[model samples]
Target: MTETDPVTAAPSGKGLDARLVVRRGSFRLDVELSAAPGDVVALLGPNGAGKTTALRALAGLTPLSEGGRLWLDGVRLDRTPPESRPVGVVFQDYLLFPHLSALDNIAFGPRCRGVPKAEARTQAAAWLERMGLAEFAGTRPRRLSGGQAQRVAVARALATRPRLLLLDEPLAALDARTRLDVRAQLRHHLADFEAVAVLVTHDPLDAMVLADRLVVVEDGRVVQEGGPSDIARGPRTDYIAQLVGLNLYRGEAEGHTVRLEAGPAITTTERLDGPVFVAFPPGAVTLHRDRPSGSSARNLWQCRVAGLETHGDQIRVDLTGELPLAADLTTVATAELGLRPGSSVWATVKAAQTHAYPA
Candidate 1:
């Protein structure tokens, strides 16, 4: 649906309900979101999809257009200033002050809110202990590791005692090993938080691990939203399909046969009719240099290799022919078949391996 179209959900007993609309030249963004207390929601999409803009609107960093409204705990917040709102934000880069000690950095927010300096430092000490960074409290930002810096940033945000917490790519700067440890730690902290938390991220794994709900936005509109498992198992768009490593097709179904809009037909075990979707993992696809005559697979197509890439231990071959598809094969099989770009191949998939659901 278009962004201007009304999209809503039943409000929970208490939390956040925001309707944001912002116009920049010819571009416009409109979205409605709701979350109950203790709820964590992740806004996930590609770059330039308005995910960050929505977060900025909630944080009061960006002014809303006419007719926009923001509410938290039954109080209006649309016109409130960022510093005045009961909101806390951890930016993408963490944005820790270079010259301030870790302890001072966490204490700054509370101190600015009129808390006594000694009391603020005491609270900062407690937060640092909670984040397992007490040993580094005296160190500056430049001396802390990526994970340590992120924890300090989170502690700083929490010190404000905000009713709404916002995070933008909270773990984007960490290395792979550090990301795992910090992500687990962050999940624990978020669980203990009693307020509503909204995070902006482009990574699906981060969304699934850190948030209770996923809102998939595209081109300034929310295209799909649900629990992580539901979104992964039943992706509605090609972008999601690619994210979850599944090949997807849209088609008109008649009984068990689904005729694809692009071309060819897929035989599925599901007894669906009318408009439908068919999806299968790349691993379920088998590729061969020559088509087998006695194969039991119900779907087979002649395809040419369009591209190839390594996916962990296996090789993923992109193909184009009757159906644009991706097939995952072992390195041994790839070498034996001389697979490469421009190579001709036959791909087959069993009906039992394909899943079909109503669109």
Candidate 2:
């Protein structure tokens, strides 16, 4: 990708365009991101990968060291203060003031921007109604449920009429049930948002459901980015592979065979050569106690079970030997085989079940 100078990039566009570089001590964060109007972009990564720092820089809460510029809807905001920028941020914890009523919390943003008290209250009331929290308008943060508090937080950010919206781990604070309900509601709200929206999340499900595009960041840099389905189908890094639940291996290929540097040769149906990647789902793997005769599976390796754990209705067995693999078996099959940790087993997968692509 060609790197564009953020400072010189034109701001007269429909969305946000930014290049951020932040340095503190020896750590540095560098990333380029863009989103069109009505687009929700998600920054996803592991812990301490600078996803939050990137969001802060975009919100003007964190200053950039150098090579940083921010533009939204034809306005340059690199030098703007956090309060002055047309940006709104919803924090991970939904930092609602304990002393303020829900209506007051939503109205606070507009009031801070110099709107009259009556007008701010009116706008806040409308937002509460839109969020389906009109009845809870007078309730304090302490009385609201987790999902309600999150909605109030989102409403507070939207009440400011920001051109750029940022949400940092918006659903991380909710319980499983609350997260499911709130995620649906947030998706609806984001769909109606007219400006650019960017959210930081480590949850792959949240990112897939809420964002139009996924930006996978690691070690303060963007490693992969694309539509959610594309990223899910073709993960570029092991972190992403783990998120998508695929057993990915990088290897050198010659036609229909790939030789893993880690000491395994996988046969694939795809006609690929040079550097390649082969991936298969855990369910595609079958484990056996004794080598089977007259089996059609092209790939077989003897492995010792490293661990075993429940995966929903199935048991996931982690094996390490010639190849490190994860195999998902039914509970009945696992019980029949008496599978346990450190048990020697054979794993097999057909070439037709394995997917190979250029690395």
Candidate 3:
């Protein structure tokens, strides 16, 4: 696509714009991405979904396919070498040099880019101060805490003043408590950054919280792209719906009823026509030991309990029968219903609980 094309164009004449294509035997990844300066877009997907491949392509670590292209700040970078490209990468493990002090590690990038040792050290010191890591300047990567090392890695990336910043699971290395604090700090730093940033992650919470926009890649292609709330409320693919904790199905809709392609029809509050997607949260489903004859719910089905697992404080029961779906219930309710695998049960959901949108 041309630079001016609405689908793949960055805002105005600058920022990031590219189509990344990579072929590895039978697997091919073709994904188009665009972002304005100061925008942070997350490449989110499941394992082996090419999120890392896309990030590597952007950093020039992976060669693009014959038809692929890369651009940043209106400058073409298709043939640029990794060391020559104005890109900074923060790897999953942080990749700090164990032998070097934190400050020296941060200075390495600037030093490699032709800056004098003293000047590079000065810049690195400033970055450490900015990232609140000046106190750990003399400490080696082995001595720094996970959160401290992460901030140091980010400082090291920023010390070179790159035009494009790429983070591959930047927060994935920290523990739960550390991740919470570091994620907030990272968000603050990213807000202050003016260059384009692309983050690759499988964590929906990370992508939704840290990114200004989300580009969901699945099976080597862009399945959906939009604001966090938009994608959360209206997921287009089963993967996305599952990521956002919603059960989804594609079907033909006529008025309030949607005839699913693979299962029973669903009744929704929306009166849509043509092909559509029906979605509802697992919590929307109510289960019963036997069918309720006087139920007010318009949608009901006789289902068999396929599986049961604890989801946080509630029990999530997987059902299979006329309609395959999931239901969430409290532990007390689960025991009261005497639910178990192979047990027969009835599931019901109000029409208002289901959402239907055009496919």
Determine which window of 10 residues in candidate 3 has minimal summed lDDT.
3-12
Return the lDDT, model 3, position 194: 94
Misplaced by over 4 Å in model 3 are 1-12
TM-score, every prediction: 0.95, 0.96, 0.95
**Candidate 3, 256-275: lDDT as tens digits:** 99999988889999999999
Global CA lDDT computed for model 3: 0.92
Q: After superposition, how far is residue 56 of candidate 3 from its true place, in Å?
A: 0.9
lDDT of 2 at 274: 98
Clashing pairs in model 1, backbone N/Cα/C closer than 3 A: none
The residue-by-residue lDDT of candidate 2 on 1-359, one tens digit each, is 23355486576657888888999887889999999989999999999899999999998889988788788887888888888998889999999999999999999999999999999999999999999999998999999999999999999999998999999999999999999999999999999999999999999999999999999999999999999999988888899988988899999999999999787899999988899888899999998999978789999999999999999789999999999989999999999989999899999999999999889
Number of the top TM-score candidate: 2
Clashes of each: 0, 1, 0
Off by over 4 Å in 2: 1-6, 9-12
In model 3, the Cα lDDT at residue 330 comes to 98
